[model samples]
Target: MSAGPEIRTIFWDVGGVLLTNGWDIDQRGRVLTALGVDLAAYEAVHDEVNFFWERGLISARDFFERTVLETNPQLALTFEQLWKLVCDESKMLHPECFEMIAHLRRAGSYRLATLNNESKELNRHRIDSFHLRRFFDYFICSGYIHEMKPLPEIYRAAIDISGFAAETAIFIDDKAENCDAARSFGMIPIHFQSPAQLRVSLAQLGIAI
Candidate 1:
């Protein structure tokens, strides 16, 4: 039997794979507590608005007005203040993962891109603050593209943009569902655990850094 096509393009997920999640449930709880806000009220509206926000269907102002400020009127914080809390929590980026990316880039052996589900304001902040553009040749984010992962269309769009066969592209994400989606779309999927595990997985696939 023939071996699979050589992996030429690598797609990375931002939240868990690249850095800490922008505003995961734990982070939200922490931020809310720090601000002395009511958690129940925020959670009541979070489920309704978070996905839409991540998909860029709503602006940051609208998200705050509808989900946070309106839902809990007693909270005495501006949108920017709350946003800063989220940003603070997201700074736990893994340096080893970035080092690996740099090594791969220096080798000039693969095309690198980020495919992530992120809200518009948060995504913009993270990318700009970290200078992630320097590392990636392209970005496939839900905020700009209006599509989140575990969906076949987003995978199709990324594959289309890279101009590579899906079979020759590898996608790395922390979520199993997202990895499964990539596999279903004929892309090699790596379920990321840690930076060390990732190095091992890539080495196994003949993608040694």
Candidate 2:
């Protein structure tokens, strides 16, 4: 068997692979439930302009206005309050993932970055709260890039931003579809399941944690 290209760069997915999905409806529900707002109605509005919000075409305030405030003029919760509740939902799903990333970072063997679909508010909250900057060299998220996962552009952007060839890159995402897209884009892809399985997968790729 032939050896594959060396993995020089790693692109991580933030929401699922490393932390609790910032997109969980429950995250929204927490804030809405507090404000006596309807989750279904708010979610319907979110589904409509989510692309704009994630693509950096709209601000978080705008998203809240369109989704919450506009529909319910009497909404008692302030944007800041609602923001904090959803932000609270963003937690480290696997401490093992953090330890692994830290070890890899110390090894100085791979360039680290994140490729994810998230709005600016959610992305910033996780990055700040989790101190993710300690591991990742940069973040290639949809919030700033105006592109989302499962799209070829965001994957390419990660490679471009990392200044590495796609063949030398690996993308780790919890979504099989996103992993498939990364594979099609000429990068090694790992469909992350859990910390234990992830360790095994990384070992298979010659990356021992």
Candidate 3:
């Protein structure tokens, strides 16, 4: 069997793939535990407000006010405090993955871009704080586009924006569903497990980093 065409563009997912999941269950648990907040009460409405929150429809203050503070008024934590905790935890990025990106850029073999799901504030903070702009040609953020992953339109939008044919590009994400969506759009998909695993996968596609 022969390998596929040379991958011209590389699409990466931020959360879980490049960085830790923003405001995910583990981070939420740690933050809430430190704040002495009730996990059950917060989770009861997290699913309802999280989508809107991630889409930039609501501010961090508003999200916490409606979901956590309003539901559990006995909690003494303020919005700023809660926001700080979440932001701090969400900004953790894998250094090896970044090194890999830098190596890919040095090789000049592929155009790198990010297809990530994040809120406006969180996204802005993360990119700026991490200096992630140096690593990618473009960023396809769900908050900016009002679209999330595992959806077809976002993948289509990425392909259009990147100016690369779907067959000549590869999308790397930690989620199987997101990878499947990329495949459905005719882009190659890589289910990222670790930097080493990703290196092997990319090597198989003639993309060494």
Top-TM-score structure, candidate number: 2
- lDDT of candidate 3 over 34-142, digit per residue (tens): 7777889788889899888887788878888988887767777788877887888965467888988999888887899999888888888888878889998888888
Model 1, which residues run further than 4 Å from truth? Answer: none
What is the Å distance of residue 142 in model 1 from its true position?
A: 1.0
| Candidate 1 structure, TM-score to reference | 0.94
lDDT of the candidates, in the order given: 0.86, 0.86, 0.85
Backbone clash count, each prediction separately:
0, 0, 0
lDDT of 1 by residue, 152-209 (tens): 7788899999999999998999999999999999999999999999999898889876
Task: Report the poorest 10 consecutive residues by lDDT, candidate 3.
Answer: 1-10
RMSD, one per candidate, in order: 1.7, 1.5, 1.7
| Two-way lDDT contest, 2 vs 3, winner | 2
